[model samples]
Target: MSVENVMTLEKKKGFTLIELMIVLAIIAILAVVLIPKSQIFKNNSKNAGVTTNVNTVRGYLETKVTNNGGADSYLNAATLKTAIASNFSLDSSTFVPTGSSSSEQLVNPFDKTKASVAVADKSSGATNNTVDTVETSASDGADGEVVIYVCKDGYVVFGVDKGGDLTQTFKVK
Candidate 1:
């Protein structure tokens, strides 16, 4: 071959700018598609973590109460709070809102200003937590009826809210 023709063939052997640009564009598109799905997967993981923590708290309470000889019925908010407080051995400092006057333990992660409890009572049932509307302890008036051992918005509830039908859907005690 001629010297000039050989030089031209060598020049064409490497990738052109257009080819490089196309490859970069494909990679960018794939990254865009995958990023959001990865975020969603991360959220699902957080939800599962919350569920596990809340259940751990519940199981502890159930075991304590069952072994204690059916000590007392949760009559009103105060009595229930005291009973739960003693049974679970939860410290009042864990209460959310940043002070002794807060009353409730944890705020919902979705809405950090609002209260959410791991164990609640349904006063006729409403929302997905039909078991019991979150209530303040009538006794202490500085603590929520539920101990809220895990992150807020944790604990999955199941079934209808009835006189005594509130129960955790999963194995959260």
Candidate 2:
């Protein structure tokens, strides 16, 4: 090849600094836009997981009550713990009951840690927001823990705190 042709070919072999900088800027912009969206999606999935767990426990309770011939009975902490231990196939590595008594814990989807199931005090009135109190307890709240509040007439309330801005609760008659 001619000397001039060879020189031009060598100069055009690689991209210019401006071209490389433009590509980097595009990538940065994409990251800025997509990173927050990915985090939102992650949080949403975790929230869904918490919801599923709450429903699973609720179903277990309902089934137990149904099998007992629709009888309204009081389910204390120990009774609930025994029922859960009997019904679910727990993995020792993940399942850890907290209290020396009969406290049971479930894995929290938000932090992947165990949360204890606590019973609310009887004096606490069962209002529309009763579940909120259970979820916001200073200890044993959130982290995938469940709270059970049994009504005098045999109704049961279940609550779960999902750590941030999300608390779920349901009532079963």
Candidate 3:
């Protein structure tokens, strides 16, 4: 082979500095664009989890009201909490059931911890789409706990976490 040809082939075997810089720049740009979006997606998923738990509590309340023979027989916050804990086989404080593993407890998605259920004040009056007020009105009033606002005609259930709060209102039918 010619010396010139050998030198040209050896030089071409390595990447240019500009090519390496361009690749790094592309990777940096992709990270800049996608990192925030990934966080948003994670938060959205946690919010959805809070929403699901609120709905589940609402459903349980509805069933309880129905089984107790209708709207006239409403459960107070303490009674409702106890009923829920017993029904779910969970402790009121930790939400983990006695003699059960952590996996069996209802977990708050945002914090990755056990979820508790509490009741809001009866006189707080019903507020729609706002969970902050409801949370403050809870009888047990703690962050990362599900709060239920019981009314004469229905129930409003909600939960708060780092991801934010989600609420669901269920009407008696």
Estimate, for each residue in 50-134, the C-alpha lDDT of model 1 and write its tens digit.
4443454466545654675432321333444454444434443332333343333333233334333333433323343322333
Please provide, for model 2 over 70-110, each residue's C-alpha lDDT reduced to its tens digit, 9 standing for 90 to 100: 52463644565566655443333334443343224454566
- Backbone clash pairs for candidate 2 read none
Model 3 has an lDDT value of 0.62
Put down candidate 3 lDDT per residue, 1-173, tens digits, no spaces: 99999998888877889999999999999999999999888877776776676677777767877888864466755666677777766776656445545543555565544555666545345454232233333334344567666554455666765434334444442
> Candidate 2: lDDT of 122?
39
Better of 1 and 2 by lDDT: 2
Give per-candidate clash totals: 7, 0, 0
Worst 10 contiguous positions by lDDT, candidate 2: 129-138
RMSD of each: 10.0, 6.0, 5.0
Q: Highest lDDT: which candidate?
A: 3
Q: Deviation in angstroms for 153 in model 1?
A: 25
C-alpha lDDT of residue 89 in model 3 = 62
The number of the candidate with the highest TM-score is 3
Give me candidate 2's TM-score against the actual structure. 0.67
